[model samples]
Target: MSELVDLRTSGRTAVITLRRPAKRNALTIELCDLIRDAATGAVADGARSLVVTGEGTSFCAGADLDAVYGDTFREALYGMLQTLTTLPVPVVAAVNGPAIGAGTQIAIACDVRVAAPTAAFAIPTAGNALAVDPWTIRRFSLLAGNGAARAALLGLEKIGADRAHALGLADRLGDLDDALAWAAQMAELAPLTLAYSKQVLNTVFEPELDAATAAELGKSFDACWASEDFAEARAARREKRKPVFRGL
Candidate 1:
């Protein structure tokens, strides 16, 4: 079977590509599981940095609504979001096109985001008879400011790449190549320092977020520390060799 997501490594950087262009890279349950597995695997492989981007015209259109309406599906979606937040390495979302609904959520879960000039972002959940999770509401408010958050949730406003950057939703305006270059640069840093730095920065932002929300996000970090990847990383440095993580 074809892989739902594609993963490749260059030096210490892991690039994860969302491959379902036919669906505008809409996130399905299987796709979410693949992403979570890839993120965990990249860390186990001793990757210092990670980049997530789409295969074609869209970064992600959003969740597969067909799968999200059911109660069981909602639980699975929540679990996937929890998994995404805990990636050990720094994650950069290279947004090449539109990012709506859950797509916006995925991008926000990353540490940083770089968007192409063609990229656009929106959250239209209100009209769809859906409400964003409490954690998402709080995080979006903190990240995009209360006004923008309300406009997104209540007004269903769609913001373009440039405007999104201006509003702080995207950290930079760039294409996929630029994002890859940035990831490569980040990969050259000392691993321990980078990990610790991410931890400290997360700590600073943790307070602005809801306590329950922040705790759920911390689960990924806790899993990382307890995984075989952590031990392999330590040994790889001592042996002057690259780590081969099993994602255990």
Candidate 2:
């Protein structure tokens, strides 16, 4: 329904594409809303599985700088990521190219990822003196192991598609066509089985935690958004220079 995102179904598989190539499929507030809507709408439209990818040479470059520094953006982004993470139908990521920042989040949110030759992933939060929530960090650790997680989040390493597949970050490496075929195959399986399996996996490692830990994690991540380093990073991007993070 949204011009920002295009949804099309193929053999019971719904494919959602981020359609903004000019900005390298960067996520805006409106785009985030459309992404969440597309996921829900696909299920409502009889889709048994879902695939997400980008329109051009990128899966997603990340969130638009202008929209990513505030609480509104964080709330919207978390909602979309959370929805995709817990979607009833299996969600696959057809990672066409470089997926950075929020783009990385979208890919990891999916139940499976099939990457193209050009596909690469990075969070680069530390490079900007920023941070992600504890849940996201924990998920990355679980998916790729503590080594890769620390490298990506702390050392600012970018993982190529092949290495990602080897690290268990990506399930496979292929084009959009291959990803769609995989989605179709998944769609034909029993829906309830997939749903239950997904739920079980999600909860298996979820620890019953205190409210204080949750609050602390939230505060630490939000604090980065309002810091001088965040502003420095934005300015550096606009000026086409390396950000000199002061850790303030």
Candidate 3:
């Protein structure tokens, strides 16, 4: 039994709710692994569609600072992201509130995203001196255009649901219940057809980075996470003010 996540199926839809409201459903290694298992298990349990949401206001506030910020955390998180995307069944991200940093990655990995009025998305990697993988950056760029992508990645701008929908980052606007209804409707579709289409569409334009490119990206990410700017971000969070980043 997973302590951090709740998986319950209703008819042909499986609902996976992140249960740690106190921490804004921040993704821990255990929680991320449970989500991966839930994705596979949901399909095995006859769920034709899956809905992922948070228990409270926050859909997911990104990685848990207490345990995340390390290579192990990134490995688990990247694994979970792949699970969300590559599962045989369609995954709906019910963004009920703010989805920050890595949380935005999870939503983008899903087949569809329906965000509520209160839901907002941001990937403030620059503020923390962190960098996402090449695939992630490419996906964001392709999904919302270069300007929006640069806004989120470089400017650290928060894109609300309305802007996200206009930018093609979010498919619709609604609450979790609306998201569940949409998933239930999708459940009536042909499984094999959906599966095949998902595979083709997802892989059609995916660019594979060469060995050197991939290694360089990893090294860059490591360097950023280990930088002095990252430490200032943490201190700023505790101090409750803007983080003054120095390009160290």
Candidate 4:
């Protein structure tokens, strides 16, 4: 496993921590792949519940924009998120700090979220002329609310911990220890019941996309990644200037 992703077990609860604090635990292709592997390993090791958190102040700033525009990166990124969502064991997100862009997606992928006072969530894709997948939009809307989703995705506003909990985005307001305690408590529950409930919830709430809709969403998503604005956003980041997007 990559050193960027750390996995360990606490009793029957597995903990996965993103370890690159210098970068605010931003997601990269390697980090995403490692996260999926770690989750799988935890399941194989008989973990009954899981908690994901970052090692430093920031839970995850987002995807590394420098490497964000590409098929490989998107595949790894969505694959990890999907894996966490489908994992039989219940997963909890310990949002220790800011969870922006892909970080917000990571928190939503888990079954529940525990946010620190400093925790905040945002997806500023519109500002950069980039876009998240359809599932991200739907999952976020379902967990939070259409109003909150619009505020985050369209208004580009950051939702803080108190507001997040009030909006139903964060299930609770607490830190890493609270998340672990919740996970540990979940580990002692009836495994089959939890698994079945999770399966039902995912399936009922998020049905499979039809082929035509899937294709249309895919084409639109690919266009954003291949757009000039996406490149400009990355370049502007490197230049330490604001990105001026042209809706190409």
Candidate 5:
């Protein structure tokens, strides 16, 4: 229902497009909530499959820098990503262009990805002195590989569409049309079976955490958000210079 996101249904397939080309469809708290609603709305509208894509040259550049450090931003972000992952029907990403940071997380949250030649994925959190949730790290490693994860997360390398497909980050390399077609085909499958398999896969892959481990992970993630390095990164952006992180 939000102007920032468009939802349309064709037969049993629903398409959700991020519509802010001016900002490369970057996520804001509002945008994240809209996306989460769109996914749920599509399913409620009898959609058996869903395709997520962007309206512009970039799928999503990342979160808007101005709002990225807000207290509620992480909750909004992970809520949307979790909705995508837990959706009853299959969700496919049509990566039309660069999917950076939270954008990469969105793509991975989907059940399958169809990337355009221009599509590339990267989570430059380390470079920006930020951190992603643990589920994102695990999903990236499982979908791609631990080696690819190390390269992207540790080495700070961008994985192009071809490399993504080869590394299993992308299930296929194709354009929007191809992605839509794939979604339509998936819609024809038995809904209950698809939902059952999806639930099982998600449950089996999830890691159970005790209170101590959970507290530690939360502390670490919160530290990055509160760190002086993140402040420096924002300052550097405004100053039009490279950030010098002290890891403080």
Candidate 6:
């Protein structure tokens, strides 16, 4: 099988590309492990910055449903997300297309996002009968807003790149060339300074803002599990029928 992720270094910048286009670059366990290794290696190799992007049409469609439906795989997936959160160097997401569900999670895990004009963002977990991870929900709320994040998660709304930029989900909206230019600029900064700055920012954001948001997300997940829609969807799926989710 082709490698799930590709990593390359250009000068002081490391570019990590999600390569599973056949699956819309979904975050699979193997793919997540590759990303974790790449991020760690980039820092160890003295790279000043890391840029993550998708290889083809879609940036990422989220977690691989077939994989995550298994409880063990779901836990592994969450562990990978935690690994991303702990990366030492600044991680920049070069969003080239649609980023939904776990795709949005990965982008938000990065310190910044540079999205293409054609890119779109969404998190339809509530509608899809799944719950977004706690960190993802908090990160989204911090990057965008509680209201905007709720709209995407709870209301299942999709926002275009322009709107995402305006809402603070994306730092810039441009093409691959623009993303590369921005990454080059970031690579020029002192590595220690960049790392320290990212550390300080995370320190201030995590315990205060993110902690509370994460707790709320857990509550939301519990609510989702207790909902009638969850049971109905489960039943419908087993019966090989289309689920009419009411989002109860």
Better of 2 and 3 by TM-score: 2
For each candidate, what TM-score against the reference? 0.79, 0.95, 0.93, 0.97, 0.97, 0.86
Question: TM-score of predicted model 4?
Answer: 0.97
lDDT against the true structure, each candidate: 0.79, 0.90, 0.88, 0.94, 0.94, 0.80
Off by over 4 Å in 5: none
> In candidate 6, which residue pairs clash?
62-102
Per-residue C-alpha lDDT of model 4 across residues 173-230, encoded as one tens digit per residue = 9999999999999999999999999999999999999999999999999899899988
1-248: candidate 6 lDDT, tens digit per residue: 23888888877788899999999999877887788787887778888778889989999999776565445556666666666676776778899999988888888888899999878889987655877766677789998889998898878999899989999999998876677778788888777787788788878777554667768866777677567786776777678787798768
Q: Ten consecutive residues with minimal summed lDDT in candidate 2?
A: 201-210
Could you tell me which residue pairs clash in candidate 5?
A: none
| lDDT for 148 (candidate 2) | 96
Task: Give the per-residue Cα lDDT of candidate 2 at 39.
Answer: 97
**Can you give the lDDT of residue 184 in candidate 4?**
100
Residues 1-248 of candidate 5 have per-residue lDDT tens digits of 66799999888999999999999999999999999999999999899999999998999999999788557998999999999999999999999999999999999999999999999999999888889988899899998899999899999899999999999999999999999999999999999999999998988887567789889998998899999999999999989999999989
Q: Which is the better candidate, 1 or 4, if ranked by TM-score? A: 4
Which of candidates 1 and 5 reaches a greater lDDT?
5
Better of 2 and 3 by lDDT: 2
TM-score of 2: 0.95
- Per-residue lDDT over 48-119 for candidate 2, one digit per residue giving the tens place of the 0 to 100 score: 999999998999998887667587887888899998988889999999999998998999899999999999
Residue 41 shift from truth in candidate 4, angstroms: 0.3
